[model samples]
Target: MASTIISKDKFQFTDTIREHLAFGIVLTCLFLFLTSAYTKIEEHDRFMNGLLKVAFISHYAWLISWTVPVAEIVVSLFLIIPKTHKWGLYGFIGLMMVFTIYIGSMLLWSEKLPCHCNLLIEKLSWGEHVVFNLAFVGLAAFALWLIKNNQYKSLIKQNDKY
Candidate 1:
């Protein structure tokens, strides 16, 4: 039927859109994580000092100074590989959530807020940083949703063919 063909075309168009959007989100997160890791590595001493200024995390600054950048790089690697893209998105979401929570906590409880680890946008206030991180979290989450939805639809299509 014409209606059926039209519906198929519509579905294909939307699926294409979703695929493109997901790809864009993945690339954006990849670039962000890679650049952030590079910046931290380049300014290792200053980054460590900034972490040391934070009252709660000052004790573990030595360990965290190395860990954070390494984790970022690992997540970037995960994002670069097609098979691991889903896990990479998960890692990205988890990292952003942690960063957002840390910033929010600092804003609420810390008497003197230390320099933020976000090398990309140093001028953003703590609140803005939270919002910024949350935005990326939302985008990544949306991309995951789209991917899941497409997989579900594919399964349904396969079932319908049987």
Candidate 2:
């Protein structure tokens, strides 16, 4: 009878799995941003009016009404291209963080909850909206970590060869 020892480096399934998971997360975020942007564009008047109802940003409603959708579209484009995917994830995380903070502020300080979100997101309550945005932010951040970790590991392996 022969005994075989398995070394850690001999198995790379974890790396492959992590890469796939990161890709899946990026794709999900891309879909979400693109859909949200499309909805805002399609219902521009309604979204702008909703933005106007929020007291803090009501003054800048005109600017934000256009900027939000445009930002979302641009971020989605970044996610679509492989070269810019990492930056897209960072953009996604930043946008989601801002959105989550906005929702939290609305919940804490505002008398009325005003949501200028897309169709599906519009259905969520203020608290649920906060949770939802935070969840995306977390997922995007995690995907970014995984990507960076994988890159670091690859660099280490390349260095070891020399």
> Best candidate per lDDT, number?
1
- Please provide, for model 2 over 7-29, each residue's C-alpha lDDT reduced to its tens digit, 9 standing for 90 to 100: 64456447888899999999999
- TM-score of each predicted structure versus truth: 0.89, 0.89
In terms of lDDT, the poorest run of 10 residues in model 2 is 1-10
Residue by residue across 99-151, what tens digits does model 1's lDDT show? 88988889998888777455778888888888989999999999889888888
Predictions in order: lDDT: 0.88, 0.88
Clashing pairs in 1: none
Question: What is candidate 1's CA lDDT for residue 51?
Answer: 86
Q: Count clashing residue pairs in model 2.
A: 0
Q: What is the lDDT of candidate 2?
A: 0.88
Model 1 poorest ten-residue lDDT run: 112-121
